[model samples]
Target: MACIQVVIWLFVVQCSAVCFANYVLKEEPEYKHTLLKRILMEENFESLESKINNLTQRVEALEKENALLKHAPVAFLAELTKSVTSQNQIILFDSVKLNLGNAYFNVHGNFIAPVSGLYQFSVTACAATNHYIVLELIVNARVVGKVLTGDTGYNECSSNSFLVQLSTGDDVYVQHKTAGDYLLANPAAGFPTFSGVLLNVI
Candidate 1:
């Protein structure tokens, strides 16, 4: 009887040890799997967030480029209506052949810059027979270019062009550098004209 009781007790002890070992093994793997899954989910979320931020920045840059393109084309051409003779006088190119942006005013004979940018300007002048004319291209009260036309044996024309940087609201026009008898109006010698175009935005 004593031997049988001891055998029963030993069997019970072995079964309890095996059950405890199986439970620990199963629970440890489930915990590790859960931890790994959570870490992977967090990494994926961070990667998606980074990609979204990069796309948003690119979209903003494209919007700015589109706005610049919308306001890019700016140009004008004007011709003198009458002769210029006095010193320090504003040469009025009253006949506007083309005015894309309305920046040139025929009344005041000046171009007010609508936007800040680099600009290219041109001026054509003519002199009557036996007379001479000196013209200066002025920008905001500063002389940017000059031209002189004289009787080189007959009526003739002279032209000048320059590139300059202008700010919004800056004034540009042609003025007589010196007093003269008269400026000729002939089609053979090119018409007295003033023209400008925006080259680039700064």
Candidate 2:
């Protein structure tokens, strides 16, 4: 009976030991799996943050581009008008006539260099007879190119386009052959007008 009791006690101890070992092994593997999952989640979060930053930068850039496009046309027209004279003067047009010789007319402005690129320039004029209007691209007080429009009737208008390479300190202007009130008479309200010249950088 004593030997049988001892044998039973040993069997119980062995079973308990085996069960504990199995539990330890299973729990360790679960802990390791949990650690690995955490690491992967951290990596994914970092990747997501990077992508968000890039998207934010792109959005900001697009906003700036949109603003520039919105203001471009107005800036272009203002530049053209400002280039005509150094002082601030009101532009007047009545019945297709531009009162360019009004006592307020002043044609003096400093030319600053524009961006270095191919620039397109255009001039439109209105006259009663086929008279000549000379458009000039002036750089540093020198005429780079002189464009002449042939005689146009008082009720006629003409446009000329030119490709010019402009640097800083470039200027442009239109001179009429006749001094008498040169007006552009056309259906357009500002017909005998100098819409002023435009320079499109390409």
Candidate 3:
């Protein structure tokens, strides 16, 4: 009877060990599969995030470039070197202070519009001790505006500004109304200056 009990106990112990090993085997494979899935998902997510960041940066760069290109870049600041005597003579702003995009404001003192747009023009004149003259801002030889400077014995100064629409290839220059009257020259060269800038592209 004792021998029979020993055999039965051995069989029960063996079956218990087999059951524990089967449980361990089943749980380990499930854990490994879950871990592998998580790792793959994390890698994929990181790759996608990197691509998204790159795309976002490119989009921002393109937006900045497009904003700059919205308006045609053109600007000029010129000053006359000497006094003009003739009535319809073009006051050459010989100094190249700032000429952007090209020589739009050339030695002939004409701000030729390269694009149809609104532009702001300015002219400052200094009065001499014995001269009086009217300077007109003429577009294509038509008197659009004028600024008068006369000797007041106080080193008088006169300046005029205008905002006008100019088409492509339109000519803009200053002209004296009378031939005999003269515009006073400034030794500093900054007092008698004519400048124009495009306000906005049309």
Candidate 4:
């Protein structure tokens, strides 16, 4: 009877050991699967972060380009072809040497401001022999500067330069201030010329 009891106890112990081993084997794959899922999630998060950083860099580059385009160059130069002698007449400088930004119109002899800014303008008026001329630089019908070539025995020229604040669409031109016999437009004496440039953007 004692020998039978010992055999039964051994069998029970062996069965318990085998059941524990099986449980351990079944849990190992689940643990490995959970670890792999966590690693993949981490990799996806890193990829998303990299894409966000790249998009931010592209946006910054585009903003810098837009700022550069806003501050482009603006300037012009014009000269008269025919003499102007009448008082209060707008001198038609029909010859355009340079019209940067297309702001200067040779047809009506006007430089309309394309953007608001501080500007520098110059006008050179030439008077024929025995004749005098008074020229005015006008901004929107208001005189900002004036030049006078007094009646001298020989042909003479006078010039005036001024700095003025201008708004967008302001009209700028040279006009006859006082009547005279002739304003020298002859190539020999030198033609009347008007020129302007944007100094700084407002």
Best of the candidates, TM-score: 1
Error of 3 at 60 (Å): 22
Q: Write the per-residue lDDT of candidate 1 for residues 56-162, one digit (tens) a residue.
A: 99998777666557785789999886776667688888888899889999999999999888899999889977898878899999998888888858878888889
Give residue 58's lDDT in candidate 2 (0 to 100).
100
The TM-score that candidate 2 achieves is 0.35
lDDT of each candidate versus the true structure: 0.84, 0.45, 0.77, 0.83
**If ranked by TM-score, best first, what sequence of candidates would result?**
1, 4, 3, 2
RMSD (Cα, Å) of model 1: 13.5
lDDT, candidate 3, residue 57?
99
Error of 4 at 197 (Å): 0.3
- TM-score versus the correct structure, for each prediction: 0.65, 0.35, 0.61, 0.64
Candidate 2 per-residue lDDT, tens place, 1-202, comes to 9999999999999999989867876789986687678877878788878999999999988876665444333111111221121112222322222222121122332223343334554455444465444444444555555444446434455666556566534554434333333333444243433332224332
CA-only RMSD, every prediction: 13.5, 14.3, 14.3, 15.0
Model 2 residue 199 lDDT? 40
TM-score of model 4 vs. true structure: 0.64
Candidate 1 residue 160 C-alpha distance from true site, Å: 1.0
Clash count list over all predictions: 0, 14, 0, 0
